[model samples]
Target chain A: MSEQIVSDSVSAIKCTNCAAPLNILGGGRVSTVTCEYCHSVLDLNDNYAVLSKFEKVKRPLGPFKIGMRGNIKGVEWTIIGWVTYKTIEFSDEEWNEFFLYSPTHGYAWLVYEDGKISLSMKVRDFDLFSWKVKKPKTLFYKKGHYILDDESYMFYIDYVEGELNWVAKFGDKFTCWDYNGVGYRSLSIEKNINELEVFHTTKLNKKDIYSAFNLEYSSKSKTRKDETFSDDDESPSVFNINKIFFIMPLLLLILAFSSLFYSKTVYDTSYRTNQKENFSIDSSAFLTSIKISVSGVGTANNKLSLYKGDEKIFYIDKQKVFFIKKDIGKSWVSNAIAVTIYLKLDKGRYHFIGEKNPNQSITTVKIEQQVIRTNYLIYALILFVFLLSIPYFKERE
Target chain B: MTDGFTVEKSINCPQCGDTLPLYFKHVKLVQCLSCKSTIFLENEATRLAGDSSVLAPEISLIHLNVPFGYEHKSYLPLGKIRYSYGRGFWEEWWLKDSEGNEYWLSIDEGDFVLEQKVDSRYSRELFNTLNVGQVTFDNLIVTETGMATCEGFEGALPKTVTKGDTYLYTHLSGKDASLTTLELGKDGVETYLGKWISPFDIKKVG
Candidate 1:
């Protein structure tokens, strides 16, 4: 196969995530290239995936002061405080640094001290009228946010004069340095949003356009797209913490009320056992089937007669053991009588009247506590139905 | 140790002394490993007694005891059984060799067949009191040929009768005899009565 001829030096990079090769901003000799897929930064290197280096500027420079007031894309924003950031050293012994600011991203003022235009600010935040940069059509700038065609970056700007000339944009990898620790970048405008895509330019339908930026989608659609990446940048912003504090109390109140309405208590007879005693129960409480048991040698062949007041409801001739099992509401009456043989039980009672021996020693009249009362489960189920119906009712109205 | 069946051992080939396993289902042939020779596996009988005594013991044959008698005379005709078509009007014979002096004969109709055998004294007492057959209350009717009726009676000795002996066959003298009731009297001496009577009497005259 004949080798296809392509340019040896073009500022083109492939998305590290999607591997879609994108022509860089200048497409010329530039120190940096931005990926179209993830809008990640790519440095010029043999590894086509050089964008991995830009993630090195995570922690900002410790403490510095910055003050600037400007109109970014017609939105007025105040830039205050400086953030010096450390970058992964490509070849030098010293770490690379970039300046950071509040509003207006991507276009940071390069801190240059010696040259005639000592403080050179590369403000790619606004839509530039010139076609000087390859693949550049438009660049938009708002408060701490910039959009170049589609790629959006939010970072701080730290511009200095003379010997140093450096700039960095730091939301998701737009960091660069050309000075001696004179400029840095910091986080800005991290929103507590349902959906926000930083960049999505996996496929280039057109050559001039490189990337796209998404600020926020609805709460539902945000989770649909790569559920892992959503809600990632929840920095200490004014909007996000206020939202958490607002919803936290309402959730706690609902949980507390649900616990109160669902309280359950069980009542059991202490004196009643398979020994010589009678057990009485109220029929309505149980939700599932109930079983009455008599075991042990003491009550072996003991006559079990259930009475509804004076009428004999059920009788066992020589019941060594007895079990009156029925669904909770199906029993004749829970108020019926249950008799046992002894307090001091014997193992021999189960053998009376040709009955199988009891597996347990206690000659107990087991008035088994059935499952939770049906009324309670029903009420809970109704409340649940009502609770679930609220959203539908609101939607319908 | 007491003698019983034992697992047999195989003899090694004479040429190579390799052990040969026993073969039973297929043709028995032994193959030698070293010289590649084949031989048949066999067993010889051993004698533990004299020639006359060892000449195979007489093979005893067991015969099933099939009793030949009027087994179901009360229930079916011998040749008529095949025509029954298994419609459940059926009876089967059972020959029982009981202890001496007891006999209980039963014939079934429909789903019920019964036969009772007891000790001799009880059998004698039953037979004496049941000389005449007991008539069931079921399916009794009056027939044309004989006034047939099911009248339960104690078994007794046969009464001697000459030419002029009168006996009523049915208790119903007001209705005609049914065919089944007449068929019952066909097996014995009987006289059909034409009218319902309060008392059925028998008179014998020489």
Candidate 2:
């Protein structure tokens, strides 16, 4: 194959270890270039000298690759370098740093670990010098207070590939400290001797990363169902449920009040009798049915009858209570009785007759045409209390 | 000066007798490729020997002969300084445009910050009073990132900067990823105005 031209004086240079042709795309800015074929670290400053070599570590293929170009947040970035770093003390934990480069945005890092990805960038305008002197245990940024989450020795570089703007070699180590706040925001402090560098990172969703790169994403590659830092099993927001408890009762109360507008008193009257007396009324003028209530209290045997012009519709007999006492002990004996009745009558005249016993005690009879209405407010209040208790029980669990 | 164009001037290395190319006219110091000797440029060119205070070229990944564009203007790297504070180290590269305008490019890890020195009169007072966290400077609230003690020096520089020097740096963020830095060094205080630029935004020119 023909050689690929990188510049006027430089074409793709062959790797010293594997003789594989490698291109230094960062031009003069890149001092270190890694050969993909043999995993050899090549020194661009010294005519691509073999600075270091490492045995290739096998792993699953990630979605990103060196030299792949994609747009992130409207800026075009190219994956110029990648490094696999593992903790010195914790060998089981490891992460990959994909060095992204954009001429306008400079450099950014995409960190992938445990099937999760986060984008980290150097924060500018931070007052690190004063913060170091204060020796603050926490860092405040973007309305969040970040506390120290983890502190570990610098990660050892296990593998390196592609062109790097900075000089990086295998086995490079430094001390690192991490701070985490609410959600995905994190602050990482890397200390190399007396120098300290701080980086801010935010977790990115897989779908957003896929969309940004315009790549086809499938669930087959997703190994974990939960996020590294997210609390997926936590209860949902309780604000909506609390608000429902307040608004529902008010609505029920309004419905109960509105029912009052449709109710009317069709008839209201009462009758009282001392002796055998009968009363009658003509056919009703109203179209709807009429309702009547009868209440009476007496000391004699009373018989009350309701009829439509002598045709008895209903009748009730009340027996008088006898006040008889045997002198077994000094005690007073008496009995009191009262009765009430309700009836729904059609549009017709009605008669009420009251008969009293032949004694000095008189029987009194009372009747009414008013219908008994149901108290809906009482029913609504009971239902409202039940609905309000539901959330209280849910919160307890 | 045309955008993305670099004008080169050739001169003999005063220390080594080897011919060297000066990429920018305003560059005060140049390092010899053959002998790695630093040469100072002025009315009478003089060689700065035993100037171990110069930053290492590999530390900053800076190449003097290469031209890079920033903010639609092309600049050439001249020299760099290595600084350390606490347990980290960073490098600042001195750059000059074709028109002799000077700027500073700070590189820490993969981050690049481009800045221009401003009046240091007010910055001295800010350095004396300002603490960590957030403070308002020039009507903008900026956070104090850290302070560092200059660990050592390597390459040629524009001004007299010594190793072991300490300075306080603060940053103010702006809309659309713009940033400003306030540097309080041994030589009073200096305010730098610039934004973070991506490596892709900088194009190499021959």
Candidate 3:
């Protein structure tokens, strides 16, 4: 949320404490500056870099080499041969120094000939001693290890007085230690003096550099803008609402036409015959028989029933037929009815071959006919009514 | 999949008569957006009014029957359902003996066995006291004791058991075996236990 550019270079020094970019201050010379967040007085001088010292002493039995690298007080350096504390006890050179390339803290161990120069930080506990007015040293810390043998060593470093030291004792138990005042405050030991070494060059990894410098680089960052869908800067479809409005009415019209106006009608002939109705056509050739046939379009079973005048007749289940004949028997003659029989049809839909007694056929005749068909207009009406009435009955159901 | 079948009319709000869009995810409940009237779809299906419920313009809700009994048991009712395209779906209740445990359960054809936690009755009582709903039962009763004439028979109780846990009961009548659906509440009191027998032809047993 906040940005600052304190350095002249494109990349700037970032604070390990506050994440704030540090500006090149005091004409590009490293100088002490206070972190605004933690109020820690950070020493940035190029003269002497702070080193943590541990002080449990053990000397190497034989000559050994300890690795070191870094810059000392802004000056580059490399590892030199180590000085053993076994040699330092009989020598006057109390400080041992070495060289490496740590730009901020210089080399690890400062080893010199004749002995080792090192700083040992001690912790004083006032409560443990009687007459307890002053504190006695409880822990001693050193930075680099001095090898007395392949199995024996002691670590030490200098934070003040600019020195480094190591003395090796094989089985002696020591409790006093020093701290590289830069990170931790103090270091102490509990069992053998040779076991007090905590940091070793062999155990170093990429993460160790980040941890030592207190700077993190592998963290992921997220923003609120990435969470939601993005809208284009220019709005192009504002007028599309009108087009949708026009399309809705057209859809409704099409639906209405499909249900109401569409009609697929099929017509055919059907026949019913008894002996009396000797109605024979010229070879009985016809496209369809409508008079005798019944149509079933939309009924529950899709069937139609056919009947005769006052008498039950055959059922014509299908839509098409040929002809229907009824018998003229002696019973009609005995009942004083003429034997010459003619077809008595329902709804006058049947065709006749002979002239109906020209005198008797002068008037109209009504026949019984049943036709089954599905009225699409009725279906459409029902759909329309249901849609229209939903608004009124929405809450009722 | 039918050609002529179409949504002829849109359901409208009862009061305003405005068309309302309907969509369902789980089919647990259907609520009218306008009037907030909720319908249980499962109830409709069980009542044989599925067609009528679907015809209604409002949302058709479904009430899911929770799978009862042990989740790991093969006879759990939810597992036995089998579905087909033209034949719909049906379930068969079967009985099996697992080690010493006997059960009448339902299971689908191809489902894998599931592992579930079985708690004790004392834990159930404690969980109930704490108002926790997820108490399970682990103790299984074996039929080492002699058979009895009543539903609750005196016998050797399950050794590992707690105070207030629930367990499923399987009843065997003649050739048929079925899991009893026990209702915990009363229709009219403090506690009333009811059982749902299968609707199909059942064998007679003394």
Candidate 4:
């Protein structure tokens, strides 16, 4: 794999238990190498002897397969190990932990739980704090602040596969304290049989993880590394000059094409109703927002309502809505005044009808449909245009 | 520091009477490459300490008299001291930069910490009374404290380190990956300040 760190020392070795071929990529400090095919833990210090075996247990499924390599930041690491753990309180709650190994940088972990993945690295440079001490709501580490998630929970290891830095058993228990930091970063302290291992984790999106392992590309991940983590060398700005240069023209270009598929009119008509019947506007083709503009000169007490077949979305009561008289210089209506009501609607086809009063005056209404996305696109284009030109006008000599 | 150092080419092993090459002039001890006897050099007098049990060549990345570098600075490794703690052993390489500034590159497992002994005026009496996890008076947090035994030595060292000599050492962590090591030995407490270096940064050169 392109993500694998190539070294002269790394070579494929056979599992001592089942003689299954395994590729070990870690350093000399690695204590155990678990065979993925036979589920046997091999102790490296003792001539690769089989320490334990789980012949009957089934291996837990994870997103990335063993031996797959991924690049985190700039360093490439191989997924050498995987451990599946279940919470003690809830048997169904489980998480799969994937161990990453870089020959020079040591070990790291990637955890998958509840459809979310997080890349974790062991925390060094520990200071004055421990689980024995009461955890504050917010705590500082390195340069970031993390908020405590909960009291903590205990979990037991259910299954294991592949090589690990330490030995693994079937039922080893560990207590975990998780804290959420800003952006996609978080802190977790895992207390096991011997030591407390704290990890600084950055939540990984689908795009990064997939691309690193050479999987099919996904563009849906919204997390940008620059937005979450800030370096001391880079000064934060409210607007990016390069993005402004790229986005203004792009948004306007998108706005011009939005009429074809998404933002165009799906339904538009003017209706004059004097009878006790409903006017239907079918918008089954589109699945976005539609603007409904209703206007009428009321003859008596009446009720106007917009609906989707049987479901009445909202109703305008004549008792509450009063038409105000206006003078337009040359023309003015004294008895009958036209009241215009504009409604921004979301979702399915609509049925507009004055169902309450039969003798209601002839209400004239125009229904125009333009998805709400076009409005934001137009606004974004104007904003980027203004932002981009401001820098050019600055630093006048 | 090797400010006024005059390079001593070779020295006779006190026990075996065999010649061993010296890279740095401020050599307090030397291990004969042939005889394997650790010889302590003080003025003109030399004493045979014992057999030097060196680590396997595969375990260490550096070699005596071999030059290595990072960034703009280059260093010549003169000697090394291997210390064994409860868990594992760590090696401290005695190196001299191009400008003759001596440094101790401590590599424990894979964690590398390059430190240089501070001047006498920089020492603090308050540093003597620090325990593990206790913050020092200088606001540095004492991260680790343990007894480390001198396993062996190779080449030329700046100080005399006898095999099986045990000393209590305390590691204090400071800001920006800065580290302060206090070695409480039979002589006294000696402190060295340096930063934690990424192992990828240190590369073996000619």
Question: Top lDDT: which candidate number?
Answer: 4
**Per-residue alpha-carbon lDDT of candidate 1 for residues A132-211, written as tens digits (9 for 90 to 100):** 23423222222222123223323332221101111224422333211111011122221112211121111111111111
lDDT of 3 at A115: 20
- Supply the global lDDT for candidate 1: 0.26
Computed on C-alphas against the true complex, the DockQ of each candidate is 0.00, 0.08, 0.01, 0.11
TM of each candidate vs. truth: 0.15, 0.42, 0.15, 0.50
Across A288-360, the per-residue lDDT of candidate 2 in tens digits comes to 2223223353443555556667676765554321112211232112243445443455555665565554443
**Candidate number of the best DockQ:** 4
* Candidate 3 TM-score to native: 0.15
Kindly indicate the candidate among 1 and 4 with the higher TM-score.
4
Instruction: State the weakest 10-residue window (summed lDDT) of model 3 chain A.
Output: A119-128
- The alpha-carbon lDDT assigned to residue B127 of candidate 1 equals 20
Tens-digit lDDT track for model 3 on B1-206?
A: 01111222234434444443322112322334444333333422311112111111211011111222232322211111121212111122222212223232221121112212122123212222221112124221111111111111011111111112223222211111111122111121111111222111122111
lDDT of 2 by residue, B104-135 (tens): 99876546788898765464676666654454
User: In candidate 2, which residue ranges exceed 4 Å CA deviation?
Assistant: A1-11, A56-61, A142-144, A150-154, A193-195, A224-397, B1-206
Please tell me what DockQ candidate 3 reaches: 0.01
Candidate 4's C-alpha runs over 4 A off are A1-8, A11-16, A114-117, A128-131, A218-397, B1-90, B95-103, B113-156, B160-206
What's model 1's lDDT at A335?
34
Worst 10 residues of 4 chain A by lDDT: A230-239
Better of 2 and 4 by TM-score: 4
- Scoring only the second chain, what is candidate 4's TM-score? 0.86
CAPRI band of model 3? incorrect
lDDT of 3 by residue, A202-283 (tens): 1122223323223242322111331232222111121232343445555555655553333221222222222122222222
